[model samples]
Target: MCIIFLTSLLLSPARTHNLEEIISDCGTKLQTFSIVQMNYDYMFVYVNGEKMGLLEDGRLALYQRFPVGSVLYDPCELPPREVPILTDAAEYGVTACKLIPYGHYEAYIPEPTTGDLHPMTGENVCVYVTNLPPNTTAEMLGRYFEAFDMVAEADVFTAPSGECTGRGWVVFQDPSKLLMVPPVLEFFPRLFIYTSLSDKIPTRTTLQLSSVPEILVPGTDIASFAEPALNHNRSGNHRRMNGKASGNFLKISNAANAGVINASAYYFVALIRRDEVEKSVEEGVFWTNPANRRAFYATLERGPVIIIFLLQEYPVIFGYARLLPDGNADKNGFSACTVEWMKHHVFLKEQDMRNIPSVPISKMGDGVPLKPEIGESICQLAEQHPSHSTILERLGQSSPNNGRHVGRGAGVVISGNGNLGGFNSVGGGGLVHSVGDRGTLRSGIGITSLPQPLGARPATRGGHIMNNRIPQRRRPYNDNSNTYVGYGGGGGSVPPRKL
Candidate 1:
């Protein structure tokens, strides 16, 4: 019975060997060791300690022929794998280590705090940062934290004067990476970083309408500058001519054709605040209130309308836009709408806004309440379609010639009897003339004189052949020459050919 009791005691975990005794046995081979106190009576053991893969009741297991070095730990002769520090506090009871400021605002290790070795809560890991550079912005702080790990959000507090207050908070998506904060602070050495396990990270306020610059608002036309020297003519006849002119001799005008102009379309100006413009420029998004949208829809009822932007003191004409029956509203309750340009329109937030020029339009008479005119329609149409002159100019481009000849038909010919005729399909190129016949030319290869008889002689002015039967030399054909000669059959002298 006593032998059985001794055997039972030998196998019991409570009677296991001491850690110091195990280290002594290991001697110089014992690089490092750690004890994880599981309960008052039992503990886990590790050599060359690591956070994982530890052996429980290690001394009892070793006595039962458990292999040495089978429960592996990092073999490198370094500090503890979890917290790399060697101190008396670590030997005592402290498991986690933190570096705090010492007497001269320098770095020093304090007694380990009592808590879970890794007390990571499943909340957003945030760190409050102080003593930041005066010029640091929220975007800059966010970018700085992004180098360490994925940051959820960052915000830097600012003074009333728009200067940074040297205070900010950064929230990380990974709670495990929060341990990197102390090392990062130590690396910087100039800043103070406090880690927190709360999700109350600071956020900036959204841009508001009042924050927009006043310059973006449309302005009223007041009396100041003199009237323009030339005014646009409304009459279609003289529309091209800017000033009053009588004759069409010069015909110098800017008149547009009637086909393209949409006479029924109305015109209106929409005002976009500076903040909205900036947002649109940056994110391609712009929003309007229901009242303004309704007004825009009303103008569209007449026909397609021209939308002008009242930018600062000038009236810059933007492109046109049509209203949709239903549109989605953003979280801020601003409905989504599209503005059309020459090519296409894109969704405000989901697409890109086209870059267009800001051309200023002239105001009409004072207190005239800017109304639609034929000139506006003409201008809009001109923008939509190319000018008639431009079409003609494109058609007038010179074509290349590779020495190929083109002709409608055989050319007209004047006969020797003062009659006009055309080349007919004779054996030779003899022009057929009729006194009162409607003349038309027939297509032929080339012009040739009628084949003369083999022994034909030259005729004299007296209707008699010369005594010598001399063969007359035919004239060489000159395509470009305007002169034409005809031979008289009888005694009638061939009338001189006239152009």
Candidate 2:
């Protein structure tokens, strides 16, 4: 429940993040409001009176927005509880944000009322930081430094010309915390992570996902991006010379890069085949490793949406499904649990996953660990599907099919090229949702193109994948070394392609 005091707000030009989702879920049901604007802006966050670090435009999530020329913040105007720093992302849950950069005031943490002494170590520690980006707030510096130790307060310096010098001092609670910092401070440039390890992957100054997806070829509007952008970490195998990538022909798009994934939500990966997906989604269960029950179930406690890296062709990311955390092991030592498959499946190919370094593609079975950014990007890109980001279980509520989904759910007429609406599903339910000449919403499982519906037969409760006798192309089984022999067309298996 977001508490937005819109009565005193002066309507003007601005933008919002995840506002439609918020309003659709709970906002509209409680109060009547409209968008402040839909443009680029800045965002800040505070947690328990402590402000966090600044990343490039981390303003992708917001409850309510402020006008362009309004007060950025006024802590004195309201009680302390009224303000929360929640502008970072939705996955972190609670947040309080200052709207725009107008009439800028302190959205920083308050100075300690106690004496200048550590609560425990009884020592004062302050580290000077330089080469900071423009308008680097003390709160952001404090948040960044807290990675090494307990930050008490942060102070920034201003130049003689009254402009910020991009230099600041981080005050830590304990002097011992300095030991945790890198010994070679001189090597840290603009805070880039240039370690002593030779095999380390190069990184960009900004540690956030690039808002814009990279294009591979010139004058080609193909559905792809030249990933490994600043925020993205493509595979180490792909080398960059003068910003021209030699390998890893990756693809991403402006639409895919749009803020979609809930950074606060957890994401897991399941390396399963496409044929088994419908059965699992129908049965509301997915299986995982048996040895590390804690590793799989403990992480799912955060409600991670399991990404299905379908073992078809080049092992592309086929679907996105959410699993209930309460999973139990079977008699033979395998784990399984109920699942809620996202209406639209994720279809990122090998190049896409390799380019997306945050996606642990090599991880086997159902234990692919994904960072918040990767999960967020995957979720955002899933919205581009024809399903319009509908959930299977929720959509199936409108029509009953004896405890089964009704052909990828009905579609609504949404603006755009109308390229992503449901087609005549395999078992048509007489509920049509076609808009314009948009393509079919099928996952392209057996056939090359669309116009064919997926088989939606009821699934039986069991641990093993049901043998439906569906003639699926053989899945390439990769070994621990990432080297595998591809099946040949002439019946003779091709030798393992040397990596």
Highest-scoring model, TM-score: 2
Positional deviation of residue 38's Cα in model 2 after best superposition, in angstroms: 67
Clashes of each: 4, 19
Q: Please report, in order, the local distance difference test score of every candidate based on alpha carbons.
A: 0.33, 0.36
Tens digits of lDDT, candidate 1, 1-499: 4455445545668656665654454543323322332321233333211111212322122111212112211223254233332235323322223211110111111212222132232233467777766666654554455434444345667787777687777665344455555523421323444434443443342111001011111122222222112211121111111232111111111222221233234444444443354444344334544444544554455346444333222222222333333344553355444554221111111011122211112221111112233223323332443222111222232223311121111212222222111111111111222111223533342333331221223234445554234555566433434433444333344445545
Off by over 4 Å in 2: 1-263, 290-293, 302-313, 331-333, 344-346, 350-366, 386-499
User: Candidate 1 clashing pairs?
Assistant: 240-253, 240-254, 240-255, 241-253
Residue 326 miss distance in model 1 (angstroms): 41
* Candidate 2 lDDT, 1-499, residue by residue in tens: 2445332122324434355654464555444433333322344443212233333443312212211111123454554233344433443322344333332233222213212212111111335556655555444444344444434334556566544476655443334354345523321222431111112232212222212222111122324543434221121123322343212222334443333322224444445544556666667665543422344454454334444334322234556666555534453235555556664354554355444334322222234334334553554544443442322332222223221111211212121222221122211111122211222433432222222112212333343344343344575665533434455433345555455
Q: What is the lDDT of residue 448 in candidate 1?
A: 38
